[model samples]
Target: MAGVWRQELSSLQAGTQNSILIGIIIHSGNPKIFEPTNPRYGFGGERAVWSFTFRDSPDDFINVTVWGSTEYINSCFKSFQVGSVVEIINSKVLSRRPDDSRDMFVPTVTSPLQITVNEGNALIQFHDSEGRAHYQPLLKMPTKTMDSLRSLNYVLQNIEELRDQFIDLLVVVTFIGEVRDIISRDGRSFKCRTFEVADASTEKTISLQLWDNEWIRLSELWEPRKTVLFLADARVGYDNFKKKTIVSIARKTLITENPSVQQALDMRLAIRNRPELSPSDPYSLPSPKNITNVMTVQQITQKLNAGSTGTDERVQFFAILYASITELNLDSKDANLLLTKCALCKRMVQKDRDSCMNLDCPSGNGSREPYNLVTFNVKLNLKDDTGYLVGCRLIGKAAEQIFGCTATEFQTMKAEQRMELKWKFLLSKFDVRMQVLGPTASITRAIYNILHMSRFETAEDISFDDIIDPMRNH
Candidate 1:
């Protein structure tokens, strides 16, 4: 006699009966058919069970099982797929429990509660008179404002406090490692991709798994140090192998790149303040010794424009400093600029931390006394009569040589005093010779590596006029 109860997926509980549910089908598994063994059990002759996942919010989802006659399931529900909006009437909720039977072939739903639909008692609607399936608009999905989003620090610290609950939460984290492909241990055809992600709130990193098609679509966009926001509703579980809290992506999970969030801005600043490279790293420029294979600024520009420059190509050239050092803000007073490295591995080691976890080193041991490395990562504008190169990163040995001191010494000088000195020293000079390496192929922007630097000898210096002229003799 009572009207049908309308409820959201999040409000549903075990033992609920005579309820009507409306949601978008986020996932649908293949139907499993069961045949009757005898006349006594052949009430419907043959029946089918279909598992479906529905969600009303980006972070909330419910697993449901639809049971009906084989013909009804095959003809009516076979066309249903992900993203289709459906309404179900007269469904009963049951507490989902881990099945101990090893005969189950598919992944069992582990939600605290699940909805079940039986023949004659349930009705399904997936289409309109136009014969087109209906879908819920993305704008209708529940979302939280930036201010309402929970901090990753709280989630990582209090994962145990919120485990096994049905509430949804959002975390802003950054991806910090490579995505690696994984195959099932059973040597079956199963495959997936896993990556390490972290947040500025803590140094701890977690493993994020992307299965099937999700991996194929998202893996290409993944890069180290990229910030991402994750909306999670599933239970937080501990990973025994990784020894960290593992966050699984469900049908309701939403991963996005929204850098406007305050948390993302803070993480980006922290990453930039601390350089990833060390002094002893091979990528860092070596001290300038011999200069050879010289080329003009015009020639270098032509090579880059023509896409003929190889990533490993090295060439020497002369250019005038176009911008003032002060304007570039190369002398920032941020303390994170001063970083320490492991003596053995040549990898970065936190100031307060004692050991290196780099798998490449034999002595992955942390040291109380880490070798301090000065970082000089800054862009300098260089120009000659023929062409100009902007945002050329002057780092390591080349930067030290030009700055006239190590990073430690430069840090001690007054910011104002140093700026004045650098201006006079650089402005007074015109013939600046530099050996630059080719830009990385992956990056679209023009960024060259400053391998070497020196002042040109007046006698050996070729005039810009001669360098720019096509017929000028060397």
Candidate 2:
């Protein structure tokens, strides 16, 4: 395995590698006899994928296999296209073909733990609408290519025009071969695996998944192995590659259009009016409906503790993490009695009073004053995005980032310090764009109402209804 790559041609398997390999990462102690791990990400195929037309293939075609872990893949999952070398471990799980002939060049392994992607070789170039070959300076990056894309620092430095945003208006591409197989969860659902897509540096074969509606409409655009101007929405897709994510266009979301000689004119107009565009639209702004108010620490804690009685359930959500489903593990009878005494911090609280008896709390026993008390539990489920379902305590000071002063400090402060901290927290939310990346799993009441309400959800809903009616009519 050591110093063996430069000497001879060889086949490899499960144990350590055998003959001298083609190339390896110099940083991993494997000498880089070939492509170095890039420093500027823009050089990778993603730039090409992003800069090119959604419907077109690169002028050339290259095929490859890749590897990596599920979590790592998911992190950059939205950025690469199929076949880009996004991983360093076997990521694709393959099924045997009916003919007993194994897939020759592409990366695939039924037993994922058994395969790994270390190096690759391919031929690819830029293509046009007629399926003819050509060369282009930039390429669109597929979701799969994200892993390696960040390494191409030199590419990005050179392309100052394509900074953080990925942009592509038009380009051409070709599929390498005949249709291989169809993949779908149910027989009615349809999807496909393509031969390969390529540009100058690399060519990648990828899988294209389609739902029933898309499959029926795909034929109008399936002029494979030929070049065509692709026009439409270009979003990232996931694939088997260890380092690259898959890039795809849906029949409805995006498309490949026929080209005419006027393509050059169209290209010029596009470049002149909007030279920076690639196959993608700019990152979009969220809908106004998504905007909402933030709640005070007292209100947030109260709602989280409100779930003990099912009849008074505070609210519902579109989705909760799989681990957050407390009902699944408990007997329905005991679960109903599962009063959430913890103050969103999972601390045992005293239901008869507003505070917890656990003087052991780092925050100290909460205020002796008659404050609100309620019961709720964490929604974290092992099936959620992180997969491990354990809810953590939500601290108010942490949510608002009260530098230097804790909630206890605020409660006992000499009015001015407490007032200053409150102003800072308020300003951070309204003026400084303080966004909580995560949904408040423990929250049930509208944050704004919490700062000024005696009654909780019941009253809040009525006000919300009133606010919504006029907007709906308008």
Candidate 3:
């Protein structure tokens, strides 16, 4: 440390020796083990290699690669994490080749040179001086300025022209999905997380992936509908599974959480009153063509019970059930049986409160007119010869299809009329097409969502004794 000269990443030169570099670690990749070989003699033992991105200033960041024995490389990785300021002494500084094949596998940084830290030749330690605080705020600064920012709308509308290219985006996160493991072609396993983000330009949200171990861990703190991101050099490509153009975090991409930009503030304000994502939203239900399976209620239960809990498994299947509705609570006076949520914020609106009562939503303000949504959230008991599926959801447009009226129209009917509508489906066999969500850590019980319903009347299946008079039962 005594003979090494301190240098900023921007001033790094090729073949620099005895130089100290100080910066905050921004992104870290998982350590990799590879067999090394020498052309003169033979193949050497397996060695570990690790790499990370760091920056000293907002405009100066570079990729640092470390090579050494597995023990040394793992020790360095455990010692530092993203946002930790560190000092590298005597690491070789080399100019990056324009045609280097490694460029496609590592993040593109602002520096023209890269740092190589080899064990026994260089030393890396956490910065201890008061000046380390200066690098902490750099983590939130956008790698690129607003002049180059592309809104979600712009990217989507121009996806054809931008396909297979990189673009910077400023978007607000709307959904944070669970992390899943994947194996690479090289037989290495890694963890990846997919999250959705949107901007003021459009209501549509796009998904981005996190492959780096550090970013995947850091994304756990990202709150849906609240965290803003400035994604630099995000790759635009086509997703064959989703059958749409998508953006992903590539090796050249860098993400700044809640970036210090005016557009980020505006994006947050624009989406403040938007509806939040919910579980098993009917709007995102699979098309009828995709729902080919027809499993019985007992078979569905068995499949759910057999599902493993090792990963975040969100198993979804569609089935057809010929069941009679035993319980429909439309005529019940219980307040919880019928509830309303604010159309804008998707929060439950109290009966006494005209608005959602969320301070962040503009409708909650007294002067502004409040808009409420009273969607059908009715639950019904479906019974078949096999078993009874209690508390199956018959909500939204699906409920409207059976009742032959909108939720608003149904609310205007009298108690007698609501009971009349309920009796039409009660104790009668109907063909119900539904989606079933298996039990997960968040929700213990299986969720049955009725997507479509229609009466089933056939000479063979019909029974005269099943028909009952509602007035006599009342």
Best model per lDDT: 3
The residue-level lDDT of candidate 1 at 110 comes to 32
How do all models score by TM-score? 0.35, 0.21, 0.60
lDDT (CA) for every model shown?
A: 0.52, 0.27, 0.78
Top candidate by TM-score: 3
**Stretch of 10 with least lDDT, candidate 2:** 23-32
Model 2, span 1-474: residue lDDT tens: 243332211223334332222211100100111232564532333211111111112222222233222333332223332222221222221333444433221222122122223222211122223312221211332212212232113322333443323222233333322222232212122333232222222222223333223222333344333443333333343334334444444322232233333542343343232211111111111111222333322323333345234343233211111112221211122232224233323355454555445564432355333222233221211221222223332223222232353444333456455445434322121211111222243643322111011112232223222222211211
Q: What is candidate 3's lDDT per residue for 56-170, written digit by digit as tens?
A: 9988999999988888989998888988999999998888998898887788788888889999889999999999999999988888779988878888889989998888888
Please, what are the lDDT tens digits per residue for candidate 1 over residues 41-94? Answer: 446578787776666655566677787788877754556655567777778887
Per-residue lDDT, model 2, residue 301, is 32
Model 2 lDDT, full chain set: 0.27
Off by over 4 Å in 1: 1-21, 26-50, 53-63, 68-82, 89-114, 119-123, 129-150, 153-191, 195-205, 211-229, 234-236, 240-474
How many clashes does each candidate structure show, in the order listed?
Answer: 2, 87, 0
- Cα RMSD of predicted structure 1: 20.5
- Per-residue lDDT, model 2, residue 24, is 17
| Worst lDDT 10-window in candidate 1 | 278-287
Report residue 25 deviation for candidate 1 (angstroms). 2.8
